[model samples]
Target: MRSQARQYAQSAQHRRAPPVRYSVAAAAVPIVAMVAAVYPVPMAVVVLAVVAVARYGRAAE
Candidate 1:
C-alpha cells in the first residue's frame, strides 16, 4: 500500500511540470511573432518557418 501511494505521488508530481512549460511557451510564441514582424522580409519568413517546425516537432511528440 505504501509503495502504491508513493508511485501515485510521483506520477502526480510529473504531471504538474507540463502546464508551466506549455504556458510559458504559449506566451513566448506571440512575442516572437511580433519581433519577427519587425525584421526584413526574408528573416521574418524564416522566423515563421522556425516556429512552424518547432510546433510540428512538439506535436509529433
Candidate 2:
C-alpha cells in the first residue's frame, strides 16, 4: 500500500545518533588511591565519588 511504502521510506531515512563516549580515568585515579587507604572508608569519600562522577561525566565546555 502507499501508506506502507511511505512508512518504509520514513524508516529508511532515519539514522542513529552518534555515541557519546568518555572516560572518568582522571577522576577515578584519585578515588582509587583514596579507596586503597588503610583507614575506614568515610562518607566524604563517597560524596567525592558522586561529585566526581557528575563532574567528569560531562562534555567539557
Candidate 3:
C-alpha cells in the first residue's frame, strides 16, 4: 500500500510539473525583456518566446 501511494504521488508530480514549468517559463518573458533593456538580451527573449510558443502548441495537442 505504501508503494502504491508513492507511485501515485510520483505520477501526480509528473503530470503537474510540465504545466508549472511551462507557466514559469512563460512568466519569465517580461523579465527577459527587462534584462534585455540593460544588455544584449533581445535574442534571449526571442529564443524564449519561440520555445514558449512551441511548447504551448505541443501542449495544446
User: Largest lDDT belongs to which candidate?
Assistant: 3
Give each model a TM-score. 0.39, 0.31, 0.41
lDDT of 3 by residue, 4-44 (tens): 95687579778774455455555576777677777875686
lDDT (CA) per prediction: 0.63, 0.56, 0.67
Candidate 2 whole-model C-alpha lDDT, 0 to 1: 0.56
Instruction: In angstroms, give how far residue 2 of model 2 lies from its true place.
Output: 40
Candidate 2 minimal-lDDT segment of 10 residues: 16-25
Question: Which candidate achieves the best TM-score against the true structure?
Answer: 3
lDDT of 2 by residue, 1-61 (tens): 7699567645754763222332334436565667757567786876786666656555442
Q: Model 2: clashing residue pairs?
A: none
Please give the lDDT score at residue 15 for candidate 2.
60
- Give, for candidate 3, the lowest lDDT window spanning 10 residues: 17-26
- Which of candidates 1 and 3 is the stronger one according to lDDT? 3
Q: Is candidate 1 or candidate 2 better by lDDT?
A: 1
